[model samples]
Target: MLPKRSISKSKPSKVWSYFVKSENGGKCKLCQKFVKSSGNTTNLTNHLKRNHKKIYLNEKQLEIGKETAGPSNVNLFNLEAKASTSKAKFPKTDSESKYSDINTDERMDSGSEYSHRSPTPTAAKNSDVNVVICTSTDSQSQSFVSQKGRKRQQRIDQSFSDISSFSEGGNKANKVTNAIIFMIAKDNCPLNITEKVGFQYLMRTVAPSYHIPGRKTISNLMDEKYEVLFKLMKDKISSIKHFCFTSDVWTDTLNSRSFVGVTVHMVCENKLLNLTIALEELSKHHTGEYLADKLSNIFRHWEIPLEKFVAAVTDNGSNIVKAISILLGKSKHLPCFAHTLNLVAQKVCEDDAIHEIIKAVKQIITFFKHSVAASDELRKRNDLKLIQSVPTRWNSTYYMLEKFVKISEDVGTVLLKFPDAPRMLTAGELQIINEIISNLKPIEQVSKEISGDSYVTASIVIPLQNCMIKQISNLSPATDIGKHLKQIILSEITKRFGEIEGVSLLTIATLLDLRFKTIHFNSPLKLSHSVMKLKRLIEESQNEIINEETIEEPTKNENTGSIWDYHMQLSSHDKRTRRENGKENNAGINELDHYFSQPLVDRKVNPIQFWFEHKLAYPVLFEIAAQYFPIVATSVPTERLFSRAGNIMDPSRNRLSSTKFGRLLFLNSLELIGIYNIQIK
Candidate 1:
């Protein structure tokens, strides 16, 4: 029998000899360019055929020579006929029309189209082997294409599964979670927002790797965040040497829940820092003792020392005032200046003559608000809308009267269209309204200027009020009712704010302020008293510093061999005695004299900035200024907290627990003041 021809099993393609194989594919040895084929040699072969034609032709000749030697030497699985046939069958089409179908009979074999690349002349001598190899390779190619599609689909599904299983502690997940929490707190969103279908869908779309936490998880996270921020805020407050607090009680109409809010203010590093320190549920009756105990607890919880409490500003409510006095001291409680001004406005509006005029204006505004046609006509005549005074908001009455005066003619025309509208104001009534607005205008402006918490409002209290009084007194009204209104406002102001300059806190603050140092004082006795009190504070501070120094024992002389040791001891004793005596006798008075002797700083200059710049020049005075400058002129900051709480206690979140509500409001306040930032780590 003839010796059997050795047939090699399928092996790596010869094209690999010119390339280096990698996990994904291989790189060409000659040009070092990558070609991806996923362990297949079709693309590798194409790379050589396109750019290395000479080498490709040489390899082809060697393969063809071996195949033609005999049928037994042929390895059918190792042939490139299938790749060539696939290329011919799926020629590259225009990119835009690459997916367009070409009509063909499904029954036809791939070999029929394979006629596009005719075989070489040498292949005809081995037609039987060539024909057999091509037929088998064609079937294998079809299976390979189908298998590739399945592998691609499997990869896509695996990626999606990986994304869905992101660990909760992953950095991306934590970042997204923090952002959601910030949004919920800042916007006062309902806790159930994360559980809503639309919110979940949005999260998934934006960050597929992040798992949307449930409402319970979000709530727990918020609690943890609040605790962390609470500790941070406490640490910050601990560094402050002095603080002024504003407190108020608000009742939520939606849930009939009562809450007390307290805000703390201080000047640190020449910047005004204010934060909401407490927003707790008021479960007990709001008596002076109950509220006082609650405030004491809050102060204790924050670790605030009694000596650090400069004062507490609140509305003129007897209960709250008594509460503050009970906790801090009788002299440590200050009534809100803006609230007092509001009272003045309210009291004057109660006059029979002004009440009738306001009543008529209210009716006209009501008609325009209810009738769309009348409102539209008014808008056409003038863009200004008639305002209705809200009893809760200060200056709202003045705003209403002022608006009516501006659009009085338009009001007449619109009222003509509605026969049932209130009668148009007479010329005399119009004159009275103008006069009232003019008189109240200066008071309104003063109220706003002093209600600020971001600047040295305490110092401006006396100056601004003095200026307002002067401005109002200069105005001469033509109408008798206007004159009566003016007199009522002046008397009310005097009755309410007449004793403000007598308060030690405001008096000293004004003295320390460069812009109005004893300049706005109407009472020489009060001014002198304020000067004496300030000098006493300075003396006390100096004594404290000296005591602290004396408490530190001097280092003992370890080696007393030198004869000058005795002289050194005597010199140190004399210097120490002279320093103590000098500070006690002249430090406070000299600093005070020096500060007052300097020309007044420009009114436009910030008082805080001025103090900071000259702290070293007037260290004793700066210390006192630090304590009093942060005392806001009004309790508006606390009032603002309640206003925000009202929005937070909307219908959807009326069932929210008081603890969570307080946390949300606290975090929101810190965010506004830039004290708290979300940490994603």
Candidate 2:
């Protein structure tokens, strides 16, 4: 081997420098022997041979380190201060090496304490450079290294510094608690999830010192949140002059308890507010009188005027219909249009081929869901898993079938692996599923559009009704499934929605939509009747406004010449001229006439926002629009609330009290509350 240079042959390493400067410096890396920090490796080689005898690579590793320890590596230990000044050098004697190991404990105990000793004669010979170095002998070793001590002490102090910086005076802790509560309320997680060891460990990882509260504390927090939200809801509902309600009944499968969910829809500050006002558990029988009494109590509790309840939109259940008739009148009940369409979809799904396809798809989904081994195998084969559909909701079924068709090949392969696989879909059956999806896609789109809570869904009812009929008529009759499904859906639509064409409430809502106006009505007579009804509503609203103004006008002192007085005079003149023109012009001319004559609003424009923007121009008509526009075409908002309630009061949380369950649902739907408002755009 070539003569080893006093340099390491290992690759240039920043990591090796850390070890060289560590407190364990001067000790052999492999054998823990104390050696001189100087270049000579005689003692280090002997220690490695004796201690690491069985390790054959020790000799090679030592040689590599000996050759590669260059000037760049020396600065790592701050040894240049001594090495630069010393022109003369002394090699390590055997006694010095032995004494170095002997005084290890004493040196470690001394830590950063420094002492000074005069330099030797050989070092003082050339020039007085004051070279500082640590020697093995206690009598010879002068001062402890000041620079290394400071750096090491800094690192030690940093590790245990105040942990308060990890959190911003408990703001981060509060956010964590808020997120936990939201998940529990939103997903209906069990209250005891906070108690789990794994969950606690996870929290500790994020905030090691934070004390997570128990379930009871979380319950109290939620109750406080609900109270703040309820006060807000009550204020919003009481402030709005008119509102339409949707109420539906749901029975908890776990406890056999029935709940009546009531959602209030009204326009407040130009944005549509769909708030679930009450979700009361009813012990009484669901008779029309009892339900009507329950509804009356709710309105009474909220301090909403009975007359201000414009209409009640509900499912076709006779008891609900009769209850609304008892509370208001028969004319005030608007049957849910989406519920009517769901009935139509149900009628179409009665076909045998469609039924069988749904059954096979359900089986495939159940197999993977219930069997871990089969699910694992399916996961390996394809990423898309089959989704099971709810029988009560036709749109869910359509989506499930759509996904099943997309991943049929992987599903077939995965099914063959299992002994009890569902029967593979036949060619004819596959065609039927594809055809059903194509036919139901348009209907599904219409359902989702009208079920929306944010925008104006009530206005879309008439246009979608007309659009669906035209779409069904235009479908090619190439497939028998398409032809049969179309006939069934069309007949159901005409039967359920045809009579709705004359419903003055729906027609008024459609006319208020800048996108539809009177154009949605196919018949000239329907348009004429709708326009007549809207004009009457506007006139009645105008008279009410005039009466209220007249009552307030006498209380204030009159001014005829001020700027405000001049503005009032211009407004009075404008209204007087319009009234005079109304008498002089055609008998049917009103805001509706002018609105209809104006070009139809842009298709992409929001009708609710349009009416809000123009409320000042046609004040009476806008007030009337508020009454009809908030009437939903479906009781789906109330139904969706029940779905959320079901998740909250699921089997694990079945023992949860009704009051607490209702409160959680209230907070979950706070985004829909008008006081917790969002901009329309």
Candidate 3:
């Protein structure tokens, strides 16, 4: 036989004709390379069984479905093809009739038509994948229609029309609103602002087009998106574990005191995380109870159990202690030790001799500050020591003491060098100069002690170094008269500062072991209330609050106003007497707060095991305290949080309707509520 012409060589009309008889071959509809009978058909059937069995089986299912679908005359699958098809198109002429009768076996050999790409008869049998549903074309109707088919059609069509109208119309917006939805979903690519353009731009591009507005429109959209982000951020914060709060209210340049409360929260770790959670503007009229109530509500909203709170740290204040007790449940108070020591120095130095000594030293300092020549002369002296400057305040008291130690000898030398030095040495000044001279050995000793093995509290060295005198009662002085000074240092060091102040929790701290055994100051008659009480006193001191004073410059010409500062106007009197004649019981009570706050020395074996190893966890201890005392100490990490919150949700851009602000507090405070742990941060 002549080599068979390739299907590609056949004319299109011949190929169509050849396809007719080949349909009778009963081959597998797909992979039509084989005939469906005898050897070839058996192999083809096995191939379908191995590879296309499910698809082939589905065709069989559709064939049966077609058969059962009502009647032969009403084939639903073929309805569309049949509805508009004309019966008249069948051959009607004699030539047409004769061609229809020709034998058709040879046409079976040709397979070109079976290999074409049109949807096959078998494919049409499966309707689900083949069904082509149309969408609605109307978007002018402003309503949420549920039909996906209708909406898709309307949206896709309108997008183009919308776009065309904007670009085409130029002056007006299209009927439909053009916008984008900024969203934060729970999965991949969690947050987004789909710069979706409206109908005007959609219609312009043949394919779907987006409308990007002018600069102002972009800015407005960005602003809106920012709002969504704030809500999410606010929510994320509210979900944190617990909240820790730290707050401080102080005088500003205006002399108006404002209370700023910051919240710290726990995020992924113990490492301090988010701070900008809640930065509540505490009203000046508010009391501790009001603060507690406000703070309690925020904690309640976050669902962080308030009972777990460690303690609320505050600048010493009683009302705040009371409020923290009420809100977070008692045992939630931790007085800032930093402030407590300042007041201690104040009470201790208030004695006539000590105060005058300090003033005399300061006078020498003033003399030098006033005249650099004197400072230079003193600095050049062999015995003079230079130390860091310490600002005076309760917090600065420790540092100021250290500063004085540094330049003390220099000052004394300056006084001795200048007979004309306005600051003449008085008896108290002499005592102070003596004290200043006495400090040289201790200063050198503390310098060495600072590096040697620590005994009681390392926290003290740096802080004490900052103050009136370092190693006040720690190291024994080697001077011939240093034995007395050494006794003073040891005796005071023996007294537990925390016990003296009444912070019971500090027993676990290093304050428990301080050895205060000096014979100079007499012991109290009876042990006083908890040292924590003093902490409370310092915390809650609002008695002489300079409430909202307007600070202004004093008049330059008035002696009473400018020339005479409160510090400068006070007359210096030499009253160095500390007589113990008949005032035995009230030795320093007339000038001090009250009785001794230190815990009495306990004479028991295993005091460590005896004191600690209580069956109760630390948190449990607070809970137990709550049952008895009205207040509880807390950590209140919130102070750390709100600081970070301000930056993250920048106040300028992170605006919210007040309701949202509360939510922001919840999110940030929840984790920070680790204050719930009853441990110091």
lDDT, each prediction: 0.74, 0.66, 0.36
Instruction: Give the Cα-based TM-score of candidate 3 against the true structure.
Output: 0.35
- Off by more than 4 A, model 1: 1-167, 556-571, 579-584, 678-681
Ranking by TM-score: 1, 2, 3
Listed in order, each prediction's TM-score against the native is: 0.74, 0.66, 0.35
Shift of residue 642 alpha carbon in model 2, Å: 1.7
Q: Candidate 3 lDDT, tens digit per residue, 1-681?
A: 799866765333211211112433432222212233342244444544453443334334444654563212211111111122333322111112311111111011112222333322211123223322222122122122223333322355544454354342121121111112111111111111223343223322211222334434433333433333343334334333334444554322222324345443332211224343344545556677777776676566444567544445666676667777787656656665434444444444454555555565556556667777776787677454433335454323334445665555556656777776756455444544355345433433443333211122222332233332434544444443435444443334344242422334432222222232111112232123333433343323221121211121233223666545554334211111211232322222321232124343443222223223431332222222222121112222333334433433433324433333333444333223221110000
lDDT of 2 by residue, 1-681 (tens): 999779768664322321122343343322222444344444444544443332223224334654663211211111111112332122111122311121321121211113233322221112423323333212212233334233112232322332332233232344345456656766678888898887776555344434677888677656655654464346335546778999999998789899889988887666777777789889988999999999999889888887987788999999999999999999989998888888888877777756866887788888889999888887887888778898878888998999989988888887788888777787777777887887787788888888877777778888998887887778775678767877777888888887777988788888888898877788888888888888777777666665665566534326755668766767666655766666523333466677778898688897768877897776667777788778888888898998899778877788888888888787677633322211000
Ranking, lDDT, top scorer first: 1, 2, 3
Worst 10 residues of 1 by lDDT: 99-108
Q: Is 1 or 3 the stronger prediction by TM-score?
A: 1
- Residue 510, candidate 1: Cα error in Å is 0.9
